[model samples]
Target: MAKTNYQELVFDITRLIPPGRVCSYGAIADYLALGSARMVGWALRNSFIHDGIPAHRVVNSKGELSGRAHFNPPSLMQQLLEAEGVKVENDRVVNFKEVFWHPEELGW
Candidate 1:
């Protein structure tokens, strides 16, 4: 077996997300048909810094922010997402249905 180039996978996932909307780690994994949320998390953590991936926009399937520690000052992701007009409360996005990015709509 070969190690996947998850860095590339992360960017590809990020590109699938449109501005003002977001996706979950599981969604990204499933979109790539990878079948593992942990793999998505690992990929995002490793690639976020240098790749300029919109890491902040990815949350857990329940819309809970789970990558706080990875952010500088530990709250940057929430702040950035909020700045983009995506509401965050208790470290989770409110009404994600209104802001969910569908890959099919974007032709991903």
Candidate 2:
């Protein structure tokens, strides 16, 4: 696939994460068969400034906001997630499993 196509695919998958839920970069990459969480992170970093992508909902495998630094102020990601009712502490999502969204399990 073309580079933009890949990024757009990542964005599309990211949008599937509902409010108050989160997914991991590895999860999105796995869902698209990309085999690289770093690729997903790159896409998010490049496209985050755009509207509707909700890159904040994507975290690391450990439920930590590993991409937090990409956001302005480096705390917007946590704030956004928290605003949506997902508790965050020490840069990690509290009760991550309960609020985690898996693309494969989603019938989308």
Candidate 3:
């Protein structure tokens, strides 16, 4: 009978990611410990409703821009990342291991 604010929660974590870094859907899901990676993706897919969410900084576990299609022009996701100094090639983040950012960095 109650609605959870998982979407807001996802946004909170996503906002914590600094520029030039990225997190994985599964990583966020694991940090919240409330839903699966798919659920995290769902929240992000509908994130356009809110501004400043920085959803582009989130990628799949493999650093793939799996949610690119959700952007206005699918390439916008990669474009955003690149603008932040995070390189992406072939629909995936370049040097993923280096750009990967963990939510725990916030002491969560």
Question: Whose lDDT is greatest here?
Answer: 3
Q: Which stretches of candidate 3 lie over 4 Å from their true place?
A: 1-4
What lDDT tens digits, residue by residue, belong to model 3 across residues 1-108? 133699888988888889999999999999898899999999998888988899999999999999999999999999999999998999999899998999887784
lDDT of 1 by residue, 1-108 (tens): 133776586667676677678898887777777658888888788765575678888888888889888888778988889888999999889988889875556563
How many angstroms is residue 88 displaced in model 2 relative to the true structure, after the best TM-score fit? 0.5
lDDT of each: 0.79, 0.91, 0.91
In candidate 1, clashing pairs total 0
lDDT of model 2 at position 25: 95
| Cand. 1 Cα-lDDT | 0.79
State the lDDT at 71 in candidate 1.
Answer: 84
| Clashing pairs counted in every model | 0, 0, 0
Give the TM-scores of the predictions, in the order they appear. 0.87, 0.92, 0.94
Cα displacement (Å) at residue 14, model 1: 1.1
Rank order (by lDDT, best first)? 3, 2, 1
| Model 2 TM-score (2 dp) | 0.92
lDDT for model 3: 0.91
